[model samples]
Target: MNTDTARAAILAQIRARQGRPAAQHAMEVADVEVDIGRHVRGPQPALGDRADRIARFTAQAQALQTRVARVASAQDVPAAVAAYLHEQALPLNGVAWDTLAAHPWAEAGLTLEYRPPRDEDKLGLTGCFCAVAETGSLVLASSPATPSSTHLLPETHIAIVPASRIVPALEDAYALLRAELGELPRALSTVSGPSRTGDIEQTIVLGAHGPYRVHVVIVDAD
Candidate 1:
């Protein structure tokens, strides 16, 4: 059986053993919604003022070795990305999410394939679902247009983050997801920085499993 169907079957069996309804009834569903709506959050760190979250995010991200660039608007993204690739001495050809196909990549002298990354692809560009300022993480929700491989399978991953989508904490990101998406996607990846591991002799090694570099371009105007 498929994963979803198997999961549902297991949960139904557990509910049956617990003497509860095998499936959620309308009243139970409404009650659960009410409980969620009235839930009180636990203590959390003070994230400072709303205006400072972006700065905090930038600082935290930089500490994790994530290169960040700020742009005034979405139209400026192409040039910013191109400059980053040039600075890193990387190629101008890469893969990007289909959602970003309308961007002026050609004008910036960058050639991008609007599809998932291949095993040999060196760079990948994508737009984030949202960003968590508390931990400086990018939330990537997988879909047909925004495949997870774009970020995971490339040597360098560039993400376009809109400033308005930056939240103060992880919990806030989850709340935003529930409110906006209603249902979770098949996969949700929270990437903090470039992949690293300290497995050999406790020496840290970047790109141990995934992208060697993560460059974020934040647009001030969403």
Candidate 2:
């Protein structure tokens, strides 16, 4: 069936299951909205101060085998990324999200294409939608400017996160998303570290599916 027909069928099934008349549909939707607005989160452990949050995030990230770095501001992001690439002996060429195209990449002596990463691309840079300090995960939302390929196809992935955007818990990340976007994006990708699996012989191997190396650059939002 066509997209509209499929959607109509799904809605019809849902309405039928609800057993509410057509006249109550509006009221049901309104009630759902109210419940969403009044959503009470479950109890969570206190994460202490902001400094503690940063420390916890760094610790968790490192424990997950992810390298983390801190920069004073956005202007320092290029230099930080460059330094990481140089330290790792990787090429200074890669694809990056358009949101970061305005940065001074040339000043850092790097070549970054502001587009989606191609199959041959080995490095990619992206700005995250938010981060979870509790789990040290970078939350990425796919959009026209920020494609999923930038984080998935590359062998080396570099993410720039604003310190202020780091929430205390994973739930807080979703709350921030809802408050800002009013709706979820087409794709929400969360990367705690480089991809790995031990399904074979119970031996760990990184980059089995995605990037072999995941580096994070935390920029001071202030």
Candidate 3:
């Protein structure tokens, strides 16, 4: 039955329950009722009310930016990025990478085979679609331009972030997307923290279904 019709019928029955005859009839277990007048429901809150919360978060996140460790800068990203890979015990090459601009790893003192998306990659590094400053989220999207495997299959992943792309919160990122694209696009992901699980007797473990660690390299003067 339509929800509005059912609601109207239930309200009418409640209003007349005391005055009308009480009749007992067999009923199915699936049918149930809700008292709507006592309940509150709606779409959600608007953006203006959420403004202060996101702004405060931006301040907190900018504070953390001062404490980023092991940061080494380069003119171009590949060389510095390669150094990060070597530090993490990853191979110099033979790791598949896909990004906004996938370049050759030769200049970084690394040599890796660039395989198709369907093949496996020991490590994957992709340029982030967006990075939310407040929650430290990295957004990714899957498309013909960005294959899904470049995100999911890799054991260790790196997010090559541009300083300009950092927003305060998930909402800010969404707003930017809406402004740039003129509507919400498909396959938006807000990845905060890392992939971890409290399985096997509640012991905390990393690297279950996704990458064990997400190394974010923020390129300066982006």
Candidate 4:
């Protein structure tokens, strides 16, 4: 076939598919939240099962948020964090500068200090400004509680997120802040999970540059 004809045929095929209904985008893994008083068993077997599928999947996502855990207030963050570190079996060797919010993170191993970045410390355990339950995103702002480098320099990042901070939807995260926090500052980042990509060969790989293991200890304050 001539070059022009071949190009025309390709364009026609593309246009035909463009008119068709496209598949929905992949759902973000975060943003699962549930009030204390709520109950739903297995899916009810019914004819309109596609809706059932969405419900079932959503329930499972909701369960994950519940399982993630929670803590009372920011002050309790440190204690809960100590438990997490003990469970994870991480040595308290490194000491990277982190934002110390009100949450009580149990820091049994880590010696809390204000230190400059050096070759010794690899772990930059920190807390975020707010948690987005919709995407399981950790929102960090430029403040004394959180430093920008902690997110990047850490080999293993452990973020302590409380349930109260978990908003119902992605947009709700911003709404809560807009009312409570006036005139937000620069550099607001939403981190979903550990840094990962499958660009090379469609094989998923974690820890490209960010933390290899991102264990979000979701604390239930209630």
Candidate 5:
């Protein structure tokens, strides 16, 4: 089932448990919709001018051990990604979102499979729906073309984010989603950095659950 259908079913079950009949449940749903339409927002931090958003996001991402790179445009993404992989001595073969299949990846000497990553694949590349400058998180809305596995299954995850898509905070990212999509995607993922765990001897262990490295390529549209 789709996200909206699943959400509706879950809410309906809750309403049923509350002893509300179908009609009353419909009314409650309507009320919730009305509130959602209002797009109420809470207090937000004072993020500086819009131009500084990239800088703030970069700093926060770096603090989380996520390497960041700046590209002039989408056309430069493949080159930048290639350069990063070479610098880190990583393989160039991996899976990528089908939506980016149009890019000149082959020209850049990169071999990216336009599908989900396999066991042998160590890298995954994807695009973000939006990015939170406050926490330096990449917000990904999953679809058939962009599966969640692309961001999780690989040992290394690389994201291509457009600078214009950066928002001040997590709330702003959600607001933008509500404005653009009436309903949420089946899977919405917010990744701040590579996976790590401090369960062993209180020492942080990278790649405990997911990718060990996360490289972000921020494309400046203008």
Candidate 6:
């Protein structure tokens, strides 16, 4: 069954257990819309101006061991990514989101498969829906064209972020999502630096559950 259908069924079961009839789908949807419209935001930290936010994001990301790079325009992304890979002595083979297929990867001498990542794929490339400056996290909305596996399954993940898409806080990211997407996608992922786990003897180990390295290439002009 589809996600919506499965969700409705689960809710129906819960209602039945509570000795109440299942609510109409339309009514439920309308109620959710109203609640969202009336939602109140909690107080947030000051993020200064746009330039300040970008600087803060860069600092925070660096602290988390995420490499950040700035490019003048979208056309410069390939070269920046290529440079990073070369510096790290990594292979130039990878997978990328289908939406990013138009970028000149070939010209940069990078071989990228425009599909979901495989077990052996060492690198993955993607674009963020928006970036949260407060936490230095990238917000990724999953769809058919932009699979989450592209970031999750690879050893290295390179994200191309548009400078204009960076937001002050996590709340702003969600607000932008609601304003633009109207509804949530299949999955929403927020990544901050490389995935690490200190579960074994409290020693941090990167790539425990995801990419060992997270690289951000910020494009000044989208």
Count of clashes in candidate 2 = 0
Native-vs-model 6 lDDT?
A: 0.93
> Each candidate: RMSD to true structure?
3.6, 3.4, 9.9, 12.2, 4.1, 3.8
TM-score list, all predictions = 0.84, 0.84, 0.62, 0.58, 0.83, 0.85
Tens-digit per-residue lDDT, 188-211, candidate 5: 999989999999799998898889
User: Pairs clashing in candidate 1?
Assistant: none
lDDT of 4 at 49: 37
TM-score of 2: 0.84
On a 0 to 100 scale, what is the lDDT of residue 209 in model 4? Answer: 63
* Cα lDDT tens digits for candidate 3, 109-222: 765544444445566666667777656567776555555566566766666666667665566676677677665446666555446678889987777777666666666554
Poorly placed runs, candidate 6 (over 4 Å): 1-36
Please, what are the lDDT tens digits per residue for candidate 4 over residues 1-222?
999988877766776687832322334212222431133333433323333333332343344332243454555656656666667776654444444533333344455444434545666666667765444567776665556667766666666655555554445566666777775657677776677788889987877867666656555553
Q: Tell me the tens digit of each residue's lDDT in model 2 across 24-52.
A: 46778899899988867888868987788
Model 6: how far is 221 from its true place, Å?
Answer: 1.1
**lDDT (CA) for every model shown?**
0.93, 0.90, 0.58, 0.56, 0.91, 0.93
Candidate 1, superposed: residue stretches over 4 Å from native: 1-40, 48-50
Candidate 4 off by > 4 Å: 1-67, 71-79, 96-107, 115-119
- Model 6 clash tally? 0
Better of 1 and 3 by lDDT: 1
List pairs with backbone clashes in candidate 2. none
Pairs of residues clashing in candidate 3:
93-111, 93-112, 94-112
> In model 2, what is the error at residue 140, expressed in angstroms?
0.5
Which residue runs does candidate 2 get wrong by more than 4 Å? 1-38
